[model samples]
Target: MASDLKVHSFEEVAKHNKTKDCWLIISGQVYNVTSFMDDHPGGDEVLLAATGKDATNDFEDVGHSDSAREMMEKYLIGEIDGSTVPQKRAYIPPQKAPYNPDKTSEFVIRILQFLVPLLILGLAFAVRHYTKKE
Candidate 1:
């Protein structure tokens, strides 16, 4: 059955990205969804945006219904050549932000925000006390 399906390269599928001739690669299968664009519930723009790349993740993320999945069979033109498509990179945890002097200074400013007001009040009290004695 695999022999019966035409195999398309990533580049070949990318060429049909326009509104008039849209195609998509989902789960390694190439689909010429031009006819279904207007009928697509998500709208044709969603399909257009998904072009020029492997949209397997985008397609699956939407959690399409079984009926939608079945409908795709009608548009199935071929399978994408795995060798021609770039392999997705493994997920990498984000790195912590580097130590920032600005952040340290911000902390100091916050502490001063409270302490400065308290210090001024204390100084005023000290002056009042001396003036009362005079």
Candidate 2:
């Protein structure tokens, strides 16, 4: 469907990251989404936040239905130039030793995690108890 569309450089797309001129890249395709921002069911900020960046992951993560996908076609402006598209960095979670419930530091953190919330709850109850109407 996009066979005849002109390719746009990332630099060109990035220039449109404002409310009145927002653009987005999704799966290497560039789209002028300024008009769609206000119409977005998720609200304009979500679409605006994705402006000037590849939003394929965020788009797919939301599990948008087929109708949403079809709606996006109307906004397609061009393909992002392959050489100019930014490459995503591979994620490597920090390697940590297996969690040990018995470790002193881990035990302390676990106690704090539990006690902090419990303490807050107790304090709230105390305040409510003291402030109750006669």
TM-score of 2: 0.64
- Best TM-score goes to which candidate? 1
Off by over 4 Å in 2: 90-134
On residues 8-90, what C-alpha lDDT tens digit does candidate 1 reach at each position? 99999999998899999999899999999898989999999999999999999999999999999999989999999987799
C-alpha positional error of residue 125 in candidate 2 after TM-score superposition, expressed in Å:
49
Candidate 1 clash figure, as a count: 0
What RMSD does model 1 have? Answer: 5.4
Give the candidate number with the greatest lDDT: 1
* Candidate 1 TM-score over all chains jointly: 0.66
